[model samples]
Target: MGEPVNREKPLRVGIIGCGKIVAQYLESFRRLQDVQLTAVADIDMERANAVAAEWNDGGAGEGGVRAVGVEELLAAPDVDLVLNLTIPAAHAEVALAAIAAGKAVYGEKPLAATTAEARRVLDAAREAGVVVGCAPDTVLGTGIQTARKAIDDGLIGAPVAATATMVTPGHERWHPNPDFYYLPGGGPLLDMGPYYVTALVTLLGPVVSVIGAASHTRAERVIGSGPREGERIPVEIDTHVTGVLVHESGVLSTLVMSFDAVATHSSNIEVHGPQGTLAVPDPNHFDGETRLFRLGGSEWETLPVSAGYVGSGRGYGIADLASTPEGQEPRAGGLLAFHALDVMESLLDSAHSGKSVAVTSRAERPSAVPLTSQEG
Candidate 1:
């Protein structure tokens, strides 16, 4: 990459989805002076308007953000960037719209409903000469980044083996609309798997092959909390998934994700090398702390994570660009995001087909260099 360009102007951004995640995006955007969330859009006019009011005004008393449709948001001349927070199925359409409109794109996870769609988005972005970014920038945060640095620095001799586990009872227990979690594109492997898998790819490099098994443990899940009371929803996707990831460096990463099991121990991703072991913090934030444990040592040592990027709150790119100025290359752009998305697609296929799937694309590790904040 060329020497980082210093952005001298504010970035005018438009958000194209309105929901719970929007609040988190707003929180991150509000902290920055370099970006302005000038517009928002959603299918629901009322919800869109409500959310816009908040972003425009800063809250109930404040003159919140404004809302529009996908087309309007993309066509707006002031919009330097588009934050595509729509559902998985709508990712490709929104992304294409933004890129074709000559705006950069930052989308939510999975990149799209399927691998084919993700490829289309990448192709479009490449043709448009604009940047596109996908979700889970959390790995770029200090917690995971610091651990990755230590491992690369040989605090842990070349990583030989690793493991990550993420389990939850189910989203229907809390999510008001949990049906999507069990559909064609919805499964433990594709849903919560990104956070853990992306962390692995970023830390250990591209996976060479994956052997796996998957199943749906529960037919239905009842809501435990939320306004939707006593709702019994069918589980159409795999509730649990397990796999072995063989990295290019010969590191074997064993991973398991489930929506049926409640794990007792803390969820973790641990990489073991000849010298020691490093436990990465949750790969879902801009920064935090980590732990290091040597084989001879009896306990885990707390390692402070040195972070320079602020959590833009919600939008993968928004959180990354909260402190970034206009016209700067997005730190979480399409190239790396596409690699992560491709890896995820390969994992899901390996699980469903009971075959070892190889990653066709090798994305550079997720980086947070372009964005700057007070180092902590």
Candidate 2:
């Protein structure tokens, strides 16, 4: 890959989605000196205009950021990269367009709705010589990273196995537009599995094969918020998914992702070896308590933070990508995202076939993050 030109300047970014999630990125951009938000776009012009108007006035300078059509934003000279926060189905389409325009791209999780689409995105970026980064960068933050440090330090000797569990009644109980959560591209596994799978990859290694089983709990769900309240949406995907991932390192990770359960008291994830077990915090958050219990210890002890971006949040991955050397993949790059997607998709496939599916994709464990603040 050719080195990106002008590495010293802050990356100029154009955003292509203005949904609820964009607000988190806007907040992060306000503090990250390595990225400059130059424009905003969305299929909903009103939403795009509102975000542009709200964020452009402050430190953006001069005429400020433009609220343009998606195509206009893609072609804008000021945009060095595209931050794609579009819905899952549109991820590959928008990313391919940005790559075609000769811009690096960072996107929200799953990379694309399917591994096939994700592969195309990665292939296109490789041919274009631009970088591709994906989310669930939450793995790069203190919560999961701290847990990773303990495991690497052998607090849990020769890691043997793990369990990751996430359960909730349903997003329809609160999400205004909960329909997408039930769509093919959405589901407990696809919607929430990225965070857990990415964290597992970060803490263990890449998954090689999976055995899975899944179930659908309901055909329709009622909206619980916004103007759509009381309305029902069809559920087209399995609501509860269970799987076992065989990591390349031979660690087995049992996974349970569900929208059918009311709650779960289990740790979001737990890694076990002969000597100890790690109680990892939620992969969805940037910071939380990580506890460890040795075999002979009286109780679990909270470990002090030892690694990763301190006080970081949603868009840290973009900033990390901006700081990465031109030809190198960012720590939260597409390869890892693709592998995580493959693992999830493979699990779903196994669920249908009642057989183990060998994952065709693998990612190098992303380099570890040393303890550091975002501005450090």
Candidate 3:
């Protein structure tokens, strides 16, 4: 691995995978000065070329984003960090390759398809002395962070429990290539659970055990968008998953994720304590209203934005990584991602075994981010 990122300079970034998600990150990267987009690569040369041509560095003088081969980009001298936007199944493989190349890595969520693979990524980064960061940086935004501030300020009193619900028809409705979504690495639980579970951990604490039940609503889904519209794809993963996470602190978080449901009026997340109930906004988004309802109150009150990166988005986690002091983990560090993955994976295992499964891994609630801005 390489030395610590120099805080005085922008962390030069090379991106891998030019999927739909890459656009969001590119938009965020343009607004973040802490990290520079240096290069891009994808299995599809057209995608690599398209993204490389799409990014306008505006003369930051880092030579602009170049379309290079995966091996070339990984071995590039100007690249300090690899921003992995690969599919969930290839997450660990790319992270390991970046670590092997001695470049620090920050990747999209789950860390890997399974905990076993995730541990290897973490272990390799550790042995190589490089940093490993992962996504759902949405929690580092005002919505969840303001909720965190409220809890930390004791406004919620002794945190008792939380409920996180995400209901969607399915990604095939919109995603151009949604096949992988039904495969091993994708599912409502693994696909959308990271945001909710990570938020639960952020609000309550680390989960010690989980009890879950899952079901498959259908074996095939007809595509509703793009050239593949109306095409049917096999569903190899659970479509709906409901679980109870027993936090180490005794806070129980109930999780409901589904691709089968039409809609729900429930808050994305709600934390209940003796004093009040907090209406946390969507964890999948960067900002929204974080409301609170006191024990004696009849109506929910919108709380002020008291924490998190202002105007943050997908790539902000990498910027956060660049700003982190050496020897300290970024808020979106690998540990949290791994813990979230373990909890989700355990829930599925429990779903299969028809018994509660104890989560062996734990991640500390990352340090709270004060109301801050990446625009600065």
lDDT of 2 by residue, 28-129 (tens): 888888888889999999999999999866655446888999999988888888999998889999999999998889999889999999999999999888
lDDT of 1 at 317: 56
Per-prediction TM-score, please?
0.89, 0.97, 0.98
Between prediction 1 and prediction 3, the one with superior TM-score is: 3
lDDT of 1 at 374: 28
lDDT of 3 by residue, 198-247 (tens): 88888778999999999987999999999999899999999999989999
Which stretches of candidate 1 lie above 4 Å from their native place? Answer: 1-7, 59-64, 308-312, 319-331, 367-376
Worst 10 residues of 1 by lDDT: 1-10
Clashes of each: 14, 0, 0
lDDT of 1 by residue, 43-121 (tens): 8888789887766564521244567877888889877778888877788888888878888778888788777888888
